[model samples]
Target: MTSDRARLREENEALRHQVATLRQELTCLEEQMSFLVNLCVASHRLHETADRRELLGILREILNNIVGSEELGIFELDAKRSVLSLVDSMGIDPAGFQSIALGAGVIGHTALTGKTFIAGDGAAPTGTGLEPGLTACIPLRCFGGDVWGVIAIFGMLPQKPALKPQDRELFALLERQAGLVLAMTRPD
Candidate 1:
């Protein structure tokens, strides 16, 4: 009878160890999930910028965080004239990006299609005058069915050949937030 009791105690101790290990793993997973959630929330908050100046800063941060890129530009579309006006941006030489026209480069293509474009090549199409590099562009559109701007991201090295599903998802999230802010601030 005493041997059976000892065996039962050992089994209970083993079960306790297993439970403890599982609890630790669960805690670690929860922490990871919490981190990802905070990133998404912070990304959304970036659009809270009150003016173009603030928005430009926020845009740079978002691209750096999400796309892992340091060089980026934001171009506003003048739909009436078919021109892409260089608005607020970061990590680029102004003299290199003046009066960049719509449909002139990857950003132009995104504006024209209202779809995101990703390029792995380090070359902007001929005649666009953009510096060669891997780039991605997301069209900016606001409520009431109006296209407002474009988000352009460039990297020193060639990017992956295709946009991953996660990349598209992030761009979509930024697009929605940017549209809301642009619509709110634009002349009504």
Candidate 2:
């Protein structure tokens, strides 16, 4: 009878451990689902927006609330001139680094190659003037395969110390949706 009782207690403890692990997995899934839903809603809103000002506001919200970054800049690309002109920015001053030439720096390289430039991946291009805190440069490419602009993310929020797959997904979404919206809203 004593041995049987000990075995029962051990089995009960194992079952409790399993339950706790399952609860943690469930919580992670729920958070992922919530992020996805918010992203979808933001994408829909971007598609529905017609005004350039309102679109910029929505972009700001996505950068701040969704991607968890406060310092960022959006630069519009002029292919003919091979230049990137700052159109909007937040948590960073846009005075000296307003315009970047193609192949000039990190932002310029991303603008030219249409590939992301992660800060920690390597040293930033010479003379890019990327702030010490800058972490990533995401090129905004339109659906037509043209690089429309670049979004320079300075740093992640303290709570988000490292970049995740979902963060990259959000960058891709911005590359497509924001590019299309900016192209549509550009004044001829």
Candidate 3:
């Protein structure tokens, strides 16, 4: 009887472990689902309007409400000189970053390479602007993968501590979809 009881206890423990693992996986799936929903909503809002100001407003909302960044700038690339000029920003003055040359700093390099540069991910050379608090530079690329601009996030909201995996997904969504709206709404 004791041996049978021991076997049952071992089995119970194994079952519990499996249950715990499954629970963790379920939580991850739920999180992913929520992220997807948010991305869809953001994309829809971005394309819902053809007005440049309205699109910019939606972009800011995504950066602030979803990505948790309060200080950010939308830069337009001047490809002739390989420069990125700040078009709009919130929560911080953007005078210093009005123009940034490609490969000159984090933001410029992110635009040039069409890569997202998150601070602390690596030793990214910082020099263009918004130093001491520059958090991320996300290159906004259209379907062809040509980077047309950049989203420079200088600071995040107080409630959030750091960027998460979901934030990266959102950045990617913005990189792919956000640029299209601007391109479509381009002025003649």
- Return the top candidate by lDDT: 3
Question: Which segments of candidate 3 are over 4 A away from where they belong?
Answer: 1-18
In model 1, the runs with Cα more than 4 Å from the true position are 1-39, 120-131, 156-165
Task: Estimate the overall C-alpha local distance difference test score of candidate 2.
Answer: 0.84
lDDT for each candidate structure: 0.70, 0.84, 0.87
**70, model 3: CA deviation in Å?**
0.8
Residue 188 alpha-carbon offset, candidate 2, angstroms: 1.5
Model 3: worst 10 consecutive residues (lDDT sum): 123-132
Name the TM-score of candidate 3: 0.84
- Report the C-alpha lDDT of model 3 over 1-188, residue by residue, as the tens digit: 99999999999999999999999999999988988999889989998999999899889998999989889999988888888888789987877888888888888888888888988897887675455588888888875888879999988888997999889988888899898788787777
On a 0 to 100 scale, what is the lDDT of residue 72 in model 1? 77
TM values, all candidates: 0.68, 0.93, 0.84
* Pairs that collide, model 2: none
Q: Highest TM-score, which number?
A: 2
By lDDT, is 2 or 3 better? 3
